[model samples]
Target: MLLQLCLLYVTIWLHSVSAQSSSIAKPGCLERCGTQPVPYPFGVGPGCSMERSFEINCNTSFNPPRAFLSILGGEIMGINPTNVRVNMPNLALSTYGQGARILTVVYGLSTTRYTFSDQNWLTAIGCDDMAAVTGLANRSFSGGCVSYCQSAGDSGGVASCPNDSNGFGLGTGCCRTPIPKGTTNLFVNLTDVHRNWRNNKLFSTSYAFVGEMVTSNFSYRLNDLNNATIFLSDNWSAKNTPPVVLDWKIGQQNCDEARRNLTTYACKANSECVNFDTNIVGYLCNCSKGYQGNPYLDPGCQDSDECADNPCDPNADCTNIPGSFICKCRKSYGGDGMKGGSGCTKLPPSTIINVSIDIDYTWASGKTEISSPSDTRPFISDIV
Candidate 1:
């Protein structure tokens, strides 16, 4: 009865696998979203991606083409299943040495799965500029790092440092701070923050944006604004901010809860759902140990041939499984027979064969005996 039940379960599992829909973008469908290669789990146009959440817009009107996030207004630089990097809009408001102009930049986040990464730093530029960046990191957290020059001369100065030096100009003139996790929404306020530091003439020109970590050397000269490129010198433009990282996930619920529903469950066969381990939201789907490729695709993750690495000893046999591999000892060996373990060891030298004979030696009565299979053939009695 138990055996029958096991067979039924196997049949059901196989059926479930066959029923999974194929959503991964294959040939004929739109593959290149702008300059970026939209892999499975993320795609361009309809029916080409895992879902609408992963849809990307390929704007072809541009000369070289460009990919844009459907919800966010930024050029997509690269997209992986787990993380994304983009150059966000460098929305800015500068006086241009004119009247006092205040620029407020607001970035709208559509879902809970993505958040500005800690890998980015909120940076502010300009000598007499004051700026503050605030965001909703699951709460109303305000007051990020502020940037303002201590004095006009402080903004520009000659410097020299070792070529091997690796560090950022945190407090010298421009200021930088970290963005909190779970922050979906972002607002940059160039309000009264920079008012006090402004001079009567074209004194305070400021800019603020989120970008990757900043590093510099002592060769920099602060007084020469044109020479400073790391933070100052007005290098950022309205169309681009420094490279920023974005986190991504696969499912709405925890790993266990998503596993119950086969229809809407994101992970395909031979894949495992992993819950988010950080303050970032949502769960990720990954191929099992010995598999590779998009776990969200039909037929599930593809098998990775681990035996190609010659993982087993020469005397042992290695069998590649769907998501794993196995090793076994050879015919006349005894040991784990693994690649790194004690390999197939030879058997002992002694050969004391035991024999068993079964026959009707007395013409009427026949009896059976048991012994080694190799020795029984040699023990047969001759007809007397």
Candidate 2:
């Protein structure tokens, strides 16, 4: 009966704690843009987000709905505090172009809190194609990859280009390179590696793009390389674009500097400031340990009731405290009360121990007096 009462109390206390937690988004603003959560400092309307750069547009005209980064116009697939997953357009080049001109695509978010995360790769898919991805940071940086087919004939090794096990474009049908850190503006250039792309009847179109490292964004079959008609249809639609991960922070200032301006600082109570790992001048906010909730909202983070999970041994007593919990062995039980530790065990209350020691010391007489060893014995009980 006592254990049941304790469990009930814990459940009630946890519910209250969770109820006191603040909203992930702003108070009056809509919490979700379609299926994607529009959490601050990213919101869908005016005065909903921290600033213009963080605004998200919920386009309801689409069949289900779509969320887009207002500044970059990139379709948002998912969002968290530190990163956003999006699908940006792909750069398609035709084989008939030859050296006439190089097709290029550019995506810029240089003034916003978002940066191209290294989790994404600049990928090119085609036969006899070369592509280069460039980012403008402290300086102009570029990386390139090429994909080629040794022979276009059906009996050739073109069928073995993409790895059979995982369908990753290794070199024959697809090639990829990592994007540099702190990339805010991206540019991709696609060109025919050889002027004889028109001669290869197997491949008519090639594509270059930057996408997150995931199977949904990159996996392709041998037929995907041969069919130029696929890229011309809905296959290259906005919804079908490759996913890209972007790192985001609250402001273009370090944690120390942002903390000094409490009125304008993004972090609320029970939260801490964290700077971006890269040289990007910005900081992010996170709930402090033992707390959970949106760090960007007021009434900020709330205590996470660890005792609600019944982490202590069944025979032990659990006490909920601010930011932590305590466990103690029940009456007549021994050992630490933690479930993972030396849990409570049955022990007799009358348990005791006797010891003997010899003392050789004198009072003020400046002489050493030997004391009986038996009197120095101490008693210890319930030592499990």
Candidate 3:
């Protein structure tokens, strides 16, 4: 019966995936729940997924299946299924009946198409206690943040070291540090150095959480260091879906070696095969310019209509070309009004005056002058 139930659940899940995929509509709806808007290259429905790794379940029961990023066993909260957010919970230590102290949490991501923001600000909070936050990325020492406080009264004021101030890290109850980009993992540690934190009785309640640098404000409190709920931000928006950049290659052999197996090399129509840099021997398929979408499949690399979306400047006219777009100035004007480099310049006033017959060139050249054409007969022309 247990096995049957498991199979049933699996079947249901599979059906849900099929339903989601079939529901994809062109320029589909942005996956959103509450205030969070899920970004592109990601979709909520099943067929919308580019790969199985990008699949997400939109649980409708919790007012939008509380966005979660699933891993092997446990799941991290606030991570939008389509977008990934790593959670590094602080390590907590405790003395039998004394309660818990120190909490540590770490987050990691695998190398794939997505790329991380170069820098993230690290924030830390402590009360007469010791705490440190650290991060590592790209096989180098990215950076860290630290916070420490010593006095109960100082818990609410600016933190500074060697003195009893409310602030701990950066001389305040809270301190933040910046991290570099392309970080694949992050680790954090929180500790009680003075052991004096025990005196506050509620000191163990203190805690911390990482978020967009501008989105979090730390309040100094002896009890916050150990409290789980305190670290969760109610207004936090986990909307950043970092881009995953992938470098794909063709067959298993080197470029020179792969060319020998032309029949199976897999370079289709309108595609070119290039040697992979990592092994000089392997090759990869790249669609010709003006073409996009997957290049490995039949009818691959569809033409992208640049003009359909109106990608030109608001005031300019757009011209669609095969696989490309061109911009021109609107009528009534005479300039090559392209965007980006060397835009149109206004015609000289002299040129305008020269083109008008009513204006006298002699007087108009140096001073304000007005003239009437000889062909004008005021009374007869006005009457007619």
- How close is every model to the real structure, measured as TM-score? 0.67, 0.78, 0.49
Model 2 TM-score on a 0 to 1 scale: 0.78
lDDT of candidate 3 over 202-224, digit per residue (tens) = 34443444443343343344444
Query: What range of 10 consecutive residues in model 2 has the weakest lDDT sum?
Result: 159-168
Identify the runs in model 3 with alpha carbons over 4 angstroms from their true place. Answer: 1-52, 72-83, 86-97, 110-117, 133-136, 140-144, 155-171, 195-202, 208-210, 215-317, 328-333, 339-384
For each candidate, C-alpha RMSD in Å? 10.0, 7.6, 15.1
Highest TM-score among the candidates is held by which one? Answer: 2
Q: Between 1 and 2, whose TM-score is larger? A: 2
Q: How many clashing pairs in candidate 2?
A: 0
Residue-wise C-alpha lDDT for candidate 1, range 1-384, written one tens digit per residue: 999999999999977654333334654566676568777767777777666767788888997788887756567788876778877745445554455455677765646357776666666554444557778876867665554455555535533321221223446445566676556788877643545655442233555676655354323344443322333334534223567788777665777777788898888778888886444446888888988766876777877788888888789898998777788888888888787999889998778886654433333445444544445333336333
TM-score of model number 3: 0.49
Number of the top-ranking candidate, with lDDT as the measure:
2
Q: For residues 1-384, what per-residue lDDT tens digits would candidate 2 score against the true structure?
A: 999999999999988766557577787887887778788888887899899888988999986678888887878889977799987765655544343233788878787878888787777767677788888865789888777666655334343233222333465667777776678898898877666654544566677777776554334455565556566566555544567898887777898888889899988889988988646688888999878898888889888888989999999989988788899998889888999999999996695777565555444456554556665533222112
Model 2 ranges off by over 4 Å: 1-20, 97-102, 153-169, 195-202, 215-227, 236-240, 345-384
Q: Cα miss at 315, model 2 (Å)?
A: 2.8
TM-score between candidate 1 and the true structure: 0.67
Structure candidate 1, residue pairs in collision: 156-222, 156-223, 157-222, 157-223
